[model samples]
Target: MQLQKKTRSGSFNILGISIKLSIVILIFFGVVFLLNKVDFPSPKKTIEKIIPNENFKIVK
Candidate 1:
């Protein structure tokens, strides 16, 4: 029946949404974990290393 089809489709939509949400959450946590494990230089340190000159600059 038409009602049965509608209910099944609604459940499928919910399942799809939940799966996508879980995947996004997992990716976010994985990124956070990897960043925590790695040691990166501070923004100031990186800025200090750059030599500002005409070659790297966009305008003359």
Candidate 2:
């Protein structure tokens, strides 16, 4: 009876790990797909358009 319980616990642990790993992998691939679909411009262009001058700087 003790041995059976240990084996069941081990199987549950493996099943849990596999499920978590699959979820993480799915999310990673989804992010990659979304990034590829979107059009991202150069950093310089984005900065220039968003902040045209130095007046928007914050002083610490």
Best by TM-score: 2
Error of 2 at 37 (Å): 0.4
Candidate 2 lDDT, 1-60, residue by residue in tens? 355434344335778789999999999999999999999876665443465686678879
TM-score of 2: 0.48
What 10-residue stretch in candidate 2 is worst by lDDT? Answer: 3-12
Off by over 4 Å in 1: 1-12, 41-60
What is candidate 1's lDDT per residue for 14-59, written digit by digit as tens? 7878999999999999999999999987766534466657557566
- Each model's TM-score? 0.47, 0.48
Among all windows of ten consecutive residues in candidate 1, which has the lowest summed lDDT?
A: 3-12
